[model samples]
Target: MKGRFSHGGGAGALARGRLARYGADMTQSLPAFAQNARFDVCALGNAIVDVLAPCEPAFLEAKGLVPGSMQLVDETQSATLYDAMAAGVEASGGSAGNTVAGVGSFGGRAAYIGKVAKDTLGEVFSHDIRAVGVHFDTPVLEDGAGNGFGTGRCLINVTPDGQRTMCTFLGAANQLTTADVDAGVIGDSAIVYLEGYLFDPAPARAAFEAAAAAAHAAGRKVAITLSDSFVVHRWRAELLAFIESSADIVLANEGELHALFETEDFDHAAAHLGRIVEVAAVTRGAAGSVLFRGGERVEVAAYPVEKVVDTTGAGDQYAAGVLLGLSRGLSLAQAGALGSLAASEVIAHWGPRPMVGLKSLAVQHGLSL
Candidate 1:
């Protein structure tokens, strides 16, 4: 896969100048010996265990959850929700975690950074992620660690329509601080991807900045996902600065893009975003995605699925496709197409990560890997 990913346009000079402004030590716009780099992407975000179960709209109403949104809950709420939901399907999940795993599924090297407690759920999260071929180097929070929050978990209620409503207990995920960021790991990667949901805790917020700084110092591209619409409302200023100052690429859905720019008009927001960032990929549910790089726009239609069982990790999988493709030297348009293919896989199942290997699916879609 050497030289598989050369930015389609004149991104080398552009990325080099932006990276230099941030003080990355590089001789050229592109990193020297890209093939020799140890990893394709280093991802940082909450490390969470996802407990998903089928439910009804009445259950969501009873639990006071907003359909299709992620809401933070306490341990008590997590326990209660877990008890009330149907039989669960436990899986390792987090926005960027899923993306990194998706990268691994595409046969790309990937690394992840985030905090989890030294407990049962934490162990499960670690094992599941490692089993997927992603490297996890962040240390676990000990039992006596401050406040001793257990490993974080998201209780996802899946309705019949394949919509998922989440109630998350961040737990030790909130304990992430700047110290968890391994500068060496980030500096060795082609890109660093961050999840917007990590904004819940103050220290975790610092962790994001630290990773961004490390990635910039290495002249690696930085990518971020808006995560959810409400998160956009909560961290509008900071997220905007993150995109403008650090991110070379941004991932979002139609709603998140509109919310970030504070408007109902998507075309206006998409145009506004492209001006500020070098690359932007916006997913539009069944309609597919639009990839923006400087002034050029490329549209990739959504990959069709016979049945949409769960939309749990669709967006994350979409980001995974694009990031995986980009990190592997696929042009942005080619990467977006792969992203669409990955998204179609996740939504065809009950879990966030794909059940069938993504590499095989790519071949099935007639994409030459």
Candidate 2:
């Protein structure tokens, strides 16, 4: 089995070996060596359970779900919607959850911070994330409303065009506070990654801000994801100021970038964006990714995929690959290439997370992972 995964014995060897023997069955567990090892990156964000269902584009119009945006719904509305929706896959997910999962998949040392409830969905969330080898330590609420006193769920409806529309019910997820962020954990990692989605809620936003402060105090870098275009539209001024003052690395897709800068032309957006964050990554779907830093532009082409299934966590996973590469001292160009490759693989599957042996896939694609 080692022979099957011993190509370079690099960052992803353990993940590769496990996947080579288990394939998609997920029975072969990643070794404890993978989790206990010191990390290059750690993430703090909402801990959410995802309820995913395939739906038509018309469903978006009918439900008034602005396609591709993650909307926050009240408890009553969330329950009503859940009861009305068809049966779907319940997966552990969140903006940063997906990113950390991707990091673990690629055999990187990754830990996550968020909150959930002590219920069925919380157990599922814990199992799924830990199974992929991410270190997650967050207290779950024992008695709460909605979803059996567990964490909130992000209802994801994937349209035929591979677009994912998300509706989030905060539940216990918003319970994450500044106290939940471990200063030791932030200091231990080479970089601390935060998801902008946390900003929508006050406690989670404070937690994110505190994490960033702690990471900088510890002389570690900070990375952030814009999360969604609509979220940017809602928090534009604040986000811009935050990016300028705090974020070392920032990620956003084309739509979110344009929305963030409130510009029609991407060129204008990119130029302005380059001035704010130390490094800015703009994903262009099939066209690839564009990276800007210190007035230099690097374009990484997308990996060719024969099939497209779901676009749920493409950006999150891509960011994972990029952060892992950057943390390991890879060049920006190489990092973006690795990001694009991982994203292509996820889109070829049905879920927001990877179903394939990502470590081996990265090795096959020439990444050290």
Candidate 3:
């Protein structure tokens, strides 16, 4: 997992100096957006509930599961896995859903758009998101009798090292369509964030394009996250096209970055990212993150946490902080620091959502909101 800059000597020194200069340019401003926008961030992705359980490494081996991969499964497969799992906890979660929830936890105005069925889990998803102070009013898909699918759910297995492996049943979550893209919501938000995990379905991909178009028409920015490395490998060409044509910001991890550029060389992938997108943020787990903007790169250190309970929503919460900070006019370095702080908090808990108020936590860490 080592990259060029991961080592010491001349190359590392050069990167550090560049990062210092980039950090000093905090006075620079981002592109202007409508000052009257209602929500700071509007996120679009699958609507799903998360079922998390702790297990031994042997459990994953026995199940023939990769320790840190996400796989799409059918309803029957999902049920069988659930039945075999140990006692677990259920919570409302999805890539974009968790990001918006993190935004709300930071006292930012946030909204969510995703498809859910008229079922029990759908009700739970709606209630949990609203309870966190995010606005979500997407029309629910009607559940037909004997359809065998009502709502989407992810079965997450967290090993002792905090790595999470997920098996997701998309179900009704894949039903999001262009018609579900509310132009008003797009226009009213400072930034519209799209989730890569939802790109598998044609309808959902269409919805992403529609939302991006609406945001641009109203002069707002659009951000996108490469939710998983597997997703990047699946749709690299399409994602590049979408980012070039529509996205103002791109968020990803080191693995996803590698997948996107089809390279093992981190420097090559990051350089390619800088040339294609206006702003890019790549998280490197414990090694921290790197931000690329206007040919400058800033490196932000990972915030300290005593223990890692689960790594489920680490990237999602990181997106939450960076997106919220950008919407509030924070510099890229400051935004990245906020992102690191938020990520640290989430990985210290069992679920993806924050256990404490992120705003308060940021203040305690000397990061002004």
Candidate 4:
């Protein structure tokens, strides 16, 4: 909420012009609930630990793995892949978890809700997220409980080109239920973010609904991210229905957006999205992103990156920036810029989380926190 920047031309002007063309009320701004909320953003997602290792394209081929796809595996399969992988780094990561952590890195009051097992990886996940300053107190699933599931973990194989292919075991993360949705946390946050990856489970889906209802009842906003193209493909109709009924904001990458609408045309998908959600932000990798609100359209360019070390968590970090910006009353164009800045920083590293202080990096990039 401090060091805000002035709106400039180009995308900003285009957005305004588009609003005028549609006769939409340009004076309507994002809700002011953030001003009084105890937390800026509370995110719900799969609680996962990521094991990242650099590999060659041949490694993926030998493993019968697609170069850049995420496939779900069982505990035995996950263990097999981990053993075959080279020395790797382990870190706490999940779509919404990374986003909330990024929010905290930008000096926002962030919180997270997810189910992890009472295991070593779960302990690591809890300690790491809290260490980053995000409020995360969701109870750990009791050992021997949760239908015999343990802590969830992801095995990520990053090729030389920085593309990441993942094998995930949901495990205890899939045990998240409506009981885990804290109405108090949902009501206290300015925005509640739900991760699409959690949509596959019945209980987690119910939890999402409960959280959305609590947020709306408390006059808070709800944001949902189409986590991946695979996720969109898996729950297209259900996701569309949820967005229409509960979400105020939608975030996605070009692939996910295209999959959601079953289209190859970006503009067509974006236009349809504008009509459904109050706000939409779609990322197009190095080409940057486009933001839509009502009938207005804003195209923000990608921030420059020196090198792309690993492409993991680019979209999650991008969500972190845009969500934080919106909570602080920034315009759509400004929010997109923050998203681009955060994304550029993450892709230049080896992990999903930012290696540098995002708040300081934002200031250096001329973006006021």
User: What are the C-alpha RMSDs, in order, of all predicted structures?
Assistant: 6.3, 7.7, 6.4, 5.8
Regions of candidate 3 where Cα sits further than 4 Å from its true position: 1-31, 144-146
lDDT of 4 by residue, 311-355 (tens): 999999999999987786677877788788889999998999999
Q: Residue-wise lDDT of candidate 1 within 1-369, one digit each (tens)? A: 111124433334223321111112422433342444678788999899999999999988987888998899988888888888899799999888988899889777899998999889889999989999999979899971247499999999999999999989999999999999999898888888998998768899899988888877776778889999999999999899878887878999998998899999988899899888877899999999998876778778898899989999999989887886666555566778779989999999888998888887776665534
- For model 2, the local distance difference test gives 0.79
Q: Write the per-residue lDDT of candidate 2 for residues 1-369, one digit (tens) a residue.
A: 000000112224332422122122421232221122266678988888888888888877988888877898977778887886777788888989999899888887798998888777778888999999988887667675455335788888888788888899878888888888888888777678999899898888999989988877776778899988888998999888888888888999998998887788998998888876767899999899998866668788898888788888899889988887666545567678779878998899777788886787877865654
Q: In each prediction, how many residue pairs overlap at the backbone (N, C-alpha, C within less than 3 A)?
A: 3, 1, 0, 0
C-alpha local distance difference test of each model: 0.82, 0.79, 0.86, 0.86
Each prediction's TM-score against the native?
0.91, 0.88, 0.91, 0.91
Model 3, span 228-320: residue lDDT tens: 999988999999889887888899999999999999999899988977777789999999999887767888999889999999999999999
Write down the RMSD of candidate 4 (Cα, Å): 5.8
Candidate 4 local accuracy as lDDT? 0.86
Score candidate 2 by TM-score against the native: 0.88
Ranking of all candidate structures by their TM-score, best first: 4, 3, 1, 2
How accurate locally is residue 222 in candidate 2, as Cα lDDT from 0 to 100?
85
What ordering of candidates by lDDT runs from best to worst? 4, 3, 1, 2
